[model samples]
Target: MARSEEQFKKIRDQRYEEISNAALKIFARKGFAGTKISDITSSINLSHGLLYHYFKSKEEIYVALITNVLELFSQAVEEAESNNGTPYGKLRWLTELTFKGDFDVALDRHMLLMEAMQADFLSQDTKEQIIDQYTTALKGIGRIIAEGQQTGLFRDGDEMELAAYYISLSQGITLWNAKGLYPIRVSADMVLDPLMKRG
Candidate 1:
């Protein structure tokens, strides 16, 4: 039986996703310096040849993962901006959405971003691109916080600072979630506490 072009395309996309997922986990855990192409392939029980078919090199995979995550982050911010809700409500919704996933997956993604920012092997162009996306997301988040402040819903503070704090809080919670020794479960409300207005 002949596989249709659409079917082939679907398979190709799936393979790319699989490679990305495996690479993301490795890159997050070990950082670029410690991660090897074989590490990603072995983690997924894939052959080096098969993995290489999807990605040319480990650096390519790293760049792809970072680009994909930043793009998703931008999309999420855009969606929140357009969603029917107050700024504070949108922030709450986003916070809940961030944590509403497999703990390890979420943690890996946060850790990946952290490591990527500090990685020195990435080209200057790639670093600048990342900074651009990050700054855009930060500005979008700041706008939301600023809007909330105007509505008397968020506390008075620098919007950009508050937005940075919001992201840091989410990342902190993600890291803490991976610590099995802790019995604490951080909530969206807890993360948003810094921004919420009080009497």
Candidate 2:
């Protein structure tokens, strides 16, 4: 009997996800330039040849990792949007949703992907794809902020600038914690305090 297309897709996705999860851990630990395909295969207890059946190279794995992170982040925002709230409330929900359990692991993977964006190992097309993904994510957040402003739920300001600032702030916190320069004692409430007070 032949496998159905849906079943094939399910198996393919499962294998890809396994490879990506292993790559995420290795990349987070050793960074993009330092990580090797062998490292990913070893982490998952798979032979290099079997790993290559799913991903051709480390660059492809890095791109897959970035794509996965963006999808997860987008899903987090979407889930937060479903909660009862005004636009500002939704934004707050989204911000807090990002820091929930296992988010630190995702954040670490995100930082390594960002570092890879600066490397020559990534092709120009891949770099552009990553940037486009980030820009789309930022614009999605900006749109929410704009909606809040229009509804008078959030204070008036340059929505794009505000969105960009928030993204930078989140990334800064991730980087700071990764460096061990700051303790992860801060709460989402502390980060949202200013926005809440202004609204």
What TM-score does each of the candidates earn?
0.94, 0.80
Question: Which candidate has the top score in lDDT?
Answer: 1
Question: How well is each residue in 54-101 modelled by candidate 1, as lDDT tens digits?
Answer: 888888998899899899889888777778889978888888778878
Runs of candidate 2 exceeding 4 Å displacement: 1-15, 78-84, 179-182, 196-199
Q: lDDT tens digits, residues 131-172, model 2?
A: 777777777788877887787665678877888777777767
**CA RMSD (A), model 1:** 1.4
Q: After superposition, how far is residue 36 of candidate 1 from its true place, in Å?
A: 1.4
Q: Kindly report which residue stretches of model 1 are placed more than 4 angstroms away from their true locations once superposed.
A: none
Give candidate 2's TM-score: 0.80
Model 2 whole-model lDDT (C-alpha atoms): 0.74
lDDT of 2 at 3: 100
Q: Relative to the unseen true structure, what is the C-alpha lDDT of residue 174 in candidate 1, on a scale of 0 to 100?
A: 77
Instruction: Score residue 171 of candidate 1 by CA lDDT.
Output: 82
